[model samples]
Target: MSARVSDATSRLKSRRDDRRRHRIVGGLVAALIVVVLAAGVYVVAFSPVLSTRQIQVSGLKVLAKNDVVATSGIVLGTPLARVDITAAADRLAAVPAVADVTVVRSWPNAVSIAIVERRARLAIATDNGYLLADATGVVFQTVSDRPGGLVLVDAPTNDQQLLVDVGTVYSALSPDTAARVDRVVASTRDAIELRLKDGDRVIWGSAEQSGLKSQVLDNLLAKSGTVFDVSAPGFPTYR
Candidate 1:
């Protein structure tokens, strides 16, 4: 009887130990599953591996949306954090129409891009092609928008430097004269010259003669077709 009792007790102890081992193993597996699930949830919810779904762009009339999108380098697979703002702006500016650009991050995984475009200021006739000048006087490129009989000017050595001064002279003309006039040639330093619709020419004389020049131009239209030199304020010359 003692031997049978001892055997029964031993068997009970072994069964208890087996149950305990199973419980430990089950707990460990459960912990591993929880950890894996948490990691997966975190990756799905907040990871930058996900593509940026929202893109907001402003100041984009002359520029095309697809062109801007392509230049941004922020495609469907591009992560929000991986985007290089400077590189994107540089790339966009390379498109020629873009003057300046600003890139900012939106909430979640969105990016916003703002662009400033260069407007066609003046048209010039080059030897091989046409020259396009912007409002700032910097020459862009030869474009097809050359209005008929529009006067083309000679590009100076420093095109950018000439743009501000010449643009000022171009803007200072009267509304009617400005509309009728086509090209202002930077023929010399002391003065700027304008080519009009007819055979008439207005000698600008000097940039200082802007207001006077505008008045002379307005008066010239009233008179017959002739060369009006507005270099002098009070005493204007006409041919």
Candidate 2:
């Protein structure tokens, strides 16, 4: 009986020791996993390997690269994961010449900037200088001297609809016809006129039927007339 009791006690002690060993091993593995994760996080978030080292620009025409870089305010050596892409793009969009901009982090050491620049479509004379407008009638740049190849506009800059109408008419002109145009004048949305490089005038009437008006003017230009009226294109008259 004494031998049986001692054997039973020994078995119980062995089972307890086994459980303690398992607990210790499990804790050590958990600690090791935590350390590994912390090291990986540090490497990715603070390491120089993924930091910005170069800048790549695309879709640039009028804006200089240096000017764009300065406007972006994205610093070199910043960790890729830490860059505020939205803020950088907002700053770039503030530039008058930029119509649309996209900023992104090209992983493993580069920042990419893609921008769409506004094309000069019309020139509006301002008190300070000339305001360059795009095809959508949004003024983008102010220049001291008049830019060539753009028709000067004499209209109320504050009248958005009038400016839009004028732009519509100007955009409808063919390259050959556009060259013959000197300036556009509008008192209201319904009263838009085109003055040719010569002393002739064209009553454009409104922004409606611009394509038909342009076609009629092409045919009328050959006739002997000082004034062309394509306002009613179906029954056009020139005198």
Best by TM-score: 2
Give each model a TM-score. 0.59, 0.72
User: For residues 1-239, what per-residue lDDT tens digits would candidate 1 score against the true structure?
Assistant: 99999999999999999999999999999999999998866654557654478778899776788879888887754566666778887788787677788887675677889988877667766656666666545565665557554446664645555655676677687767877676687755566788777757888766776776787768766876578887786777777
Clashes of each: 1, 0
Window of ten residues with lowest summed lDDT in model 2: 133-142
Candidate 1, poorest ten consecutive residues by summed lDDT: 149-158
- Cα lDDT of candidate 1 equals 0.72
Candidate 1 at 160: error in angstroms?
4.1
State each model's CA lDDT, in order.
Answer: 0.72, 0.89
| Predicted model with the maximum lDDT | 2
Model 2 per-residue lDDT tens digits across residues 73-128: 88888888888889999999998789999998898889899999999989998787
Prediction 1 TM-score vs. true: 0.59
